[model samples]
Target chain A: MSTRIHRRRHAKNIAAQVLASAATLLALAFLVWILWETISRGLQAIGISLFTKITAYADQGGLANAIVGSAIIDAMAIALSAPIGVMAGAYLAEYARSTRLGATIRFLNDILLSAPSIVLGLFVYVIVVLPMTAVTNGTTTFSALAGSIALALIGLPVIVRTTDEMLQLVPSTLREAALSLGIPQWKLTVQVLMRAAGSGILTGVLLALARLSGETAPLLFTAFGNNYMAFGPLEKMASLPAAIYQYTNDPNPALHAIAWAGALLIALFVLALSLLARTVFARGKTSHD
Target chain B: MSVASVTLDSNRGRDRTDARNDALFRWALRFCALLVLAALLGAALSTLWGGREVLFGDGWRFLTSAQWNPVENRYGAWAPIYGTLVTSLIAIVIAVPLSFGIALFLTEIAPAWLRAPIGTGIELLAAIPSIIYGMWGLFVFVPFMAAHVDPLLDASLGRLPWIGTLFQGPPLGLGLLTAGIVLAVMIVPFISSVMREVFQTVPVRLKESAYALGSTTWEVAWDIVLPYTRQAVIGGIFLGLGRALGETMAVTFVLGNAYGLTASLLMPGTSISSSIANEFNEAAGLHRSALIALGFLLFVVTFIVLLIARWMLRSLQRKAGKA
Candidate 1:
């Protein structure tokens, strides 16, 4: 009687485990389907002309202008954000240990880190783009510079949080040793601490870039969508996300195809960045261990 | 006397070197710290200056009016605000439990061989760009929902009181309910991944102890694991909620951009981000400032949500450490 009861219980447990496993598998399968559908639909529009030619509303145009514009804005954002983010992170980790002000700063930084990208864009639109449009009579309405500034703001908090966390992970003994040798605190941070946390900081920056690259809502107001090619920061330019948005809504089949292609490219870019960060972090861990 | 004087001179030289280094480093650190503060301040100040007109002029009235007309310079943000809140709440309601279930399954039931690949798959979902989600939501998912999901809901619950009101519509599948569903799908991966990570931090010894006591897997998970990681799970949910609330592209694509409060979940609605995205280009003069004001409102709301999330996470961390 006891043996029979145990066997039945064992069977029931196994069945439950299988059911749970199936549920998790189903969740993962949904993700896989989404990816497969995006790629198959998007890959059809990939062609040499897609990369080389500028967008023309009349004859289905390429993403050349959008690609260039995205690159420039991304570059500018990184350049502007890195210095400030790294410095703030260093201060939080090294100087602000257990202080009231440090705690406050950390709290505020966390708030900024998770704040919506759309809000940031709106903030920029209200402050920068709207004012500029008013001053310039809407002729110089949207520019790459304004877009870069908004992206930089979005990038800053992520960089700061990552840098601070990475710096904190570095052993205090290392800092003490450098200080004992009569090395300046600034030099110790830049030369020793920053170098120690280099891979992690880079990972954060890459993640931030990936996050901002796909941002559409923020750019909608500040960058304002462009259909033509323009090179300078002062001129209106297009980006992949904005282009995808524009094309996806259009009734034209050709524009729809381009939108799919743009989606695939953006996904691929983000995936590559994630893989790169993972690889870099894995290598760093092995070396440290 | 000579030896004493030489020793003093050596000590003074070392002290001077230390002082100089400290001074230089302190100056540099201070300068960098100030720059960080400036960046944070700049973001806040710019928004305030740009949004001042709408904020001070209308006060709370801006939030009460439902109409958003850019042509006639009339602006009321109620419609978008309502849509944003309602859709985000719907997403949270769906995503939180689903994520928790997935996390529970992964931590307790899944075989070791399957964990890594499944975990990575979920993380990959999180990494996919928002635009792709928007495109997918626009093309395939919305249509699918319209055809199957909406009809099923309408058929089953169409006669109920509150539930009936929600499901009542033409089944267009491009509205607040659709946006909420998409947001839930988009954020599920993020919340589940975080929850799984936190769940893993529950020591193996704790599970083994429960098992040794002849506890069933479900019992162990509920009595031992769930309590241990409840705070972290809450934090994860809040983080996901933050993303869903601020989500722009996907929601914008499917939300139909109608500005009004509707009792039916299937009806089209506007969100703050969608409103700004759709109309920022065409808006002129005070209409522009009003739009900026809407942005300001969004910023304030997100800022508060994030602050709470951060606080919750920190408290969770402290609790876990104590445990």
Candidate 2:
């Protein structure tokens, strides 16, 4: 009787392990399906015309305008965010350390980091876009500038948190040695600590960029997505993700195909950036402990 | 003596300049840190400012009413609010068990060779853009569900009393159920990753002692690991809830963007993020303010959910530290 009970218990253990593993494999199968569907269906719409023309109401053209617009907005967003994010991160890591102020900033930054992109879009629409439109005499405009600011807000906390975490990884021993050599706190952070944490910070910034690039909701209210190719940051500009959203909702099969291609392009870019971040971090060999 | 004094003066002058530069640099970083504070303040203030018209102009009926006519300037958010809650609740139901299982597999059962790569593959799903998920859900998953899954559910569970109404609708390929499932798929990675981290915090000694006492893997996991991480597991579920609540594009594509609320999950619905994303443009005056107000409400809800999750994790950490 004891031996039979032991066998039944052993069988149950094996069954449980198999069940858990099966669950994981099932999850993976879904991931595989999504990738497969994206690549197979997405590739059909990719061509030179996709790179050469502006989108239209009737869905005859490509995502060329959106491509340019996305690049412009991304450039502006990165430029606006990088310096400030890095500086804030430096303060959290080196200057404030663990003060009450630091703790408050950390807490707020955490909230900001995960705050909905749509809410950020609403924020910018109220503060920047609406006021600017009113100022421009009801031009019905949604400038790329407004979009960039919204994207910058989305990326800010990500970069700050990454910078702070990366800087925290720099050893206290290093700080002590540099201080003993008469290095000033600010100088030590900028010249010594920043250099040590460079790769990790770069990884964080790149991932944040990838994240912002795919954001559609925030740009919907801010960029407002122009049909025509825009010239500068002052004008409303189309972006790939917004284009995808618009086209996907349209009844035209051609537009749906275009949306698929756009989705693939955005996904590829995001995945590449994520992989690059991992590679850079691995190569840095920095102190994770 | 004169040469030594001159050298000392030069050294002191250089030190003074260094101090000045240092002060400037620290101030600059501090200023940048304050920019984030300013932005956070700006966001909240703008929400309050933008929704000012809705709050004061429309009065309290905006919360209770269901009519949202952009043409007529009559706005109510009850449908979107209801939809967001119900869909997120469904998502939690679908995601929590799967995430826990995935976390367990990764931590306790996955092979040494498979662990890192599998872990990475799962994390990569989180990197997949929400828009892509939206597209895929619209084109592939929804149709697949409408054809195969929904009818099967109807046949199996729908024939029963009381449960039939939930499964009675013609699977139109996009609705609350589809949106909830897509959200569940989207958030599984994030929740599972959190779960994996929390599970890793469970000491090896306890698990090993259980094994030495001839505890089956299931017995050890259930009796030891589950009790240890119960708070954190709930926290992970809430974290997933927060993501589902705020998620825009994915739900927008699959939720059918219906204007009204309904009893059945099979029927179409609208979420706060989706409603705003769908109608914010050309939403003149009161309509626009209403959308912004909707966003504020979403922000408040998500903030509360996140705080609860954070509290749970903090308590778990304190217990872990003490133990």
Candidate 3:
């Protein structure tokens, strides 16, 4: 009877192993399948015109305007978010380490971290868009400025959390060593601690940028996609993800191809950013050690 | 003597300036931190204020009713809410076991040389944007489902006596079940990575002792590791649940944007985020408010789920630290 029990258990073990291996294969297969579809379709749509021409009607044109617009919006967003996020992170690490208020803010910030991007869009729509529309008489509610603000909000919590964590990781002994030198608290945090945690903080920023580059839902109502190239932050602007969304919805096969191409661009950009962040972080860790 | 006195005065002035600068810098940092708090409060209050028109107008009926009509200016949250819950439920059911298997494979089964690459591969899956998933789901996956999987399911599961209605729909293939499967794929990386991390936290000594007792690998995983990391495992699952619930783009593509709820999982349905995404652009006045209300609801729901997950994970971390 004991031998029979052992035999059944061994059979179960074998079955579990098979299931696990299959599951891993299945997960990897889906990844390959998705990447393959994007690359093959995207390459077919690639051309010089894609870089030179502005978008036209459903069957024609390229994504020049959208790419440029994406760059502008994303750049402005990083400009706005990086400083504020760094300071907030510094505060959390330096002053509020054991404070109740700091803990509460951390919790709320975390909630904000995973809060739906669409809701942030809505929040901006109501807070910035509707008010601006009302003040301007509906001619300029949806603008690149509003979109950047939403993206900045999305990026903020990420930077703050990473900065706080990275600063914490900078061995308390370093803080004591700096403090013992009679350096002011703010200067010590800015000079010594920030320098030590610089790469990790930069990694956070790059990851945030990668995340923002692909965001579509928040931009839908805020940036509100345009066909022509518009440089001013006050005007509705085209972006890669928004353009991809529009073209994907279009019934034209040609437009669908362009959308795939755009998706591939965004995907490659995001992957590269993340890869860069990882290498920077690994190098930082090694040098520190 | 006169030059030395002037230099002393200058040094004192510099010290005073430094002190003032230090105070200013400290306040600036505090202001930035407060700004983070203010952003959250602002979002919540503004969403509440925007949706007040619908929330107060519909009262509690909004929660219970599924009817949505723009022509008559009537709307309810029932259908979208139901779709959101059901799709997330389907995602959890499909993802949890697969995630467990993947986690087990990563932590225990794989050879040492293969681990890092496979782990990175899984993490890369999480890095891909949701919009790409949506695009793929609409053009590639939906067709694949309609042509192949739907008919297979209908032929087999639809023939069952009791749970057959779900499989009995026309093979349109853009429905709750399809969206759920896509969501499952989107969340697998998150769940599996968390699971793998928590599993690794199990002490090598405990695992070695279990092996010494002649326990199978399956027994070690199922009985020992699972029990050891119970809270964290649940926390990981809830984290995935939070992501699935708030997911917008992926579901928006393949969900067919249909209104109303049905018993069949094959019928197309609308989720809250999809509803807001599809209509917020064209909607005006009350219609717009209703969509905002839906966004508000999505926020609150995800917030609660993530809070629970954070609590569980934090508690476990504290216990680990203490040990």
The prediction achieving the highest TM-score against the true structure is 3
The sequence of per-residue lDDT tens digits that candidate 1 reaches over residues B24-111 is 7666655766655665566566666766777788778888888777767677789999999999999999887777768878888777
Please identify which of the two predictions, 1 or 2, would achieve the higher TM-score against the true structure. Answer: 2
Clashing pairs in 3: none
Tens-digit lDDT string for candidate 2 (A1-289) = 9999999998988988988888788788889999999999889999988888889643678999999999999889989898899999999998887798987787778777767889989989888987887888878568899999999998899899999999998888999999999888787888999899999899889988988998999999888788889977888899999999999988989899888888889988889999898989888864443
Per-residue error at A42 for model 2, in Å?
1.2
lDDT of each: 0.80, 0.87, 0.91
| Worst-scoring 10-residue span by lDDT in model 1 chain B | B34-43
DockQ scores of the candidates: 0.51, 0.73, 0.74
Candidate 1, lDDT over the whole model: 0.80
For residues B1-323, what per-residue lDDT tens digits would candidate 2 score against the true structure? Answer: 69999999998998998899988998899999998888877877888789879967877788878897777888888889988988898888888888878898998888889899999988888888899889999999999999998888777777778877777677787888999999988899989998998888889999999999989878888899989898998887887888899999999989988877677788899999999999888677888889888998888888788777777876887787787
Task: Give the Å shift of residue B259 in candidate 2.
Answer: 2.3
lDDT string, candidate 3, A100-123, tens digits: 988988888887887888999999
Superposition-based RMSD of candidate 1 using all C-alpha atoms, in angstroms: 3.5
Question: Least accurate stretch of 10 residues (summed lDDT) in model 1 chain A?
Answer: A15-24
Proportion of native contacts present in model 3: 0.68
User: Where is model 2 chain B poorest over a 10-residue stretch in terms of lDDT?
Assistant: B306-315
What local lDDT score does residue B224 receive in model 1, on the 0 to 100 scale? Answer: 90
Off by over 4 Å in 2: A1-8, A286-289, B315-323
Candidates sorted by lDDT, descending order? Answer: 3, 2, 1
